[model samples]
Target chain A: NAGVTQTPKFRILKIGQSMTLQCAQDMNHNYMYWYRQDPGMGLKLIYYSVGAGITDKGEVPNGYNVSRSTTEDFPLRLELAAPSQTSVYFCASSYSGQFSYNEQFFGPGTRLTVL
Target chain B: AQTVTQSQPEMSVQEAETVTLSCTYDTSENNYYLFWYKQPPSRQMILVIRQEAYKQQNATENRFSVNFQKAAKSFSLKISDSQLGDTAMYFCAFMTRHTPLVFGKGTRLSVIA
Candidate 1:
């Protein structure tokens, strides 16, 4: 089974360009998270969703928005991408009921470069 | 605020030998979880191992084991008989139920043949 999948493995955008990072999972997990990794830095949470139709702000959610309309899809939108928003984005999912929050499966990651 | 720290930015080990990567954290909560995640060149995050704060015993997964020192707030991962595939960036992370996870900068490991 494909655990977590993120589309647009690589992208380049302008200073004011807008784009969406798509994520999907077939595991039917209730918890999904969006994290970004900068050069030589750890992954920082951008947003999270406890379940379908419910999304919440994370530590670094300034330029991103997420919607979990279905159990399998979570899309992150960047209204006006900035240079600072350029980083490698990852989508992770977990089954928290039976497993701990640390047990998460991550996607391959989307590399975005903002010029 | 919870924070995770991995002092070593990079490490190297000889094949078939054992190596340890250190991780320390600070938190006020009594109950939480600690994890070690491996990221290869592909950049896909994989769970290496996990330990619960409430559990005193260390967590082990085959050749991978963790030394969990709750009082010192230190968790270190030890790999036995290291293989070439063990070379990757390892990240230490912490999280509590309903709370976001805190991750360290990460340690890049290289196993030489």
Candidate 2:
């Protein structure tokens, strides 16, 4: 199965512009997450969904929004993009918190540059 | 709150040699999970190994193994006979039942031939 997939492997946005980073998982995972990794740094969570229709803010959720309308899709929206939002974004899925699950499979990631 | 720390920012090893990546975490939860993920140049996050806090024995996956020290809050990954393909950024992550998974800054490992 394509564990998880993210669209737009690369993107460049102007300040005040907006875009959506699409993510999907075919594994029917109950948990999906959005994370951003700046150059030479670890990833910080932006948002997450335990299940469809249940989304929550993560460590760094400013300037972004998310929705999990279906089990397979969790898309992140960037509004009024700023240079600070320049980073590599990742989408991951897992069977987390259910019956002792192990790992979270991730997508290749989307590299965003805001100018 | 839980925090994962990878002290070594970068490390290198000769081909066929062994290397260890150190990780430490802080958490009050007694039962939780720890994970090590490898991100190659392709930017794919690959799960290398994982450990459960309740388990006394460390977890091993083929050439990759973890030295889990629950008392010290340490979870180190040891790669045996490092190969060129093993070169990647390794991140240590922590998660408890109540909180979101937190990740360390990561240690860059270079396996040189």
Candidate 3:
């Protein structure tokens, strides 16, 4: 069903470069999120959107931006990629904010290396 | 801020044996949710199991089960009759309906023959 799809499975960017990680979900979920996974650190939330046009900052939001223009799409932007920004980025979606229905369906992560 | 911890960086077990992955979390909210997510080499995060704070009974899914201790703030995952395909990175996450999840460093499990 292509629950969640992320574009550019892998990318390499020079310092100061800009790029966008595209994420789309066909499930029409209300909650969408962006998280980055480092070597030993677990996935850290970057940004989240409850619905279209409503976005909020997460635990780690520096050097990144996000937009939820439609229920099916949530894209994360890297304005000035830095070496510290190198990590595997994942996009996820859930039915709602309720804990009972909180299981998130994640997309195939996008591995980005900032050099 | 809430935090989840997986003390074990890695663990190994023989096929058909049972293994337990330890996890502990810190949170002030009494109402929240805990989850175990499995990430294979492919890096896709899949939900293995979930538990609610109010529920005292453990949650079980197939060969996977959880030991949720509210007072101790501990949640451990137990896999019975583990198979070769069970090898993966397991992450413990905490979340409330009002906020996003706080994930642990993760424990890499290797099931060998």
Interface RMSD of each: 2.5, 2.1, 1.7
Residues B1-113, candidate 1: write the lDDT tens digits.
88999999999999999999999999988889999999999898889999999999999999999999999999999999999999999999998765778899999999999
Query: Once model 3 is optimally superposed onto the true structure by TM-score, how far is the C-alpha of residue B108 displaced, in angstroms?
Result: 0.7
Can you tell me which runs of candidate 3 are displaced by over 4 Å?
A98-101
**CAPRI quality band, candidate 2:** medium
lDDT tens digits, residues A48-101, model 2?
999999999999999999999999999999989999999999999988564244
Evaluated against the true structure, the overall lDDT of model 1 is: 0.92
- Each model's DockQ score: 0.63, 0.61, 0.72
The 10-residue segment of model 2 chain B with minimum total lDDT is B93-102
Specify the poorest-scoring 10-residue window by lDDT in model 2 chain A: A95-104
Rank order (by TM-score, best first): 3, 2, 1
Error of 2 at A49 (Å): 0.3
Displacement of residue B105 (Cα, Å) in model 2 is: 0.4
What DockQ number belongs to candidate 1?
Answer: 0.63
Q: What TM-score fits each model? A: 0.97, 0.97, 0.98
Clashes of 1: 0
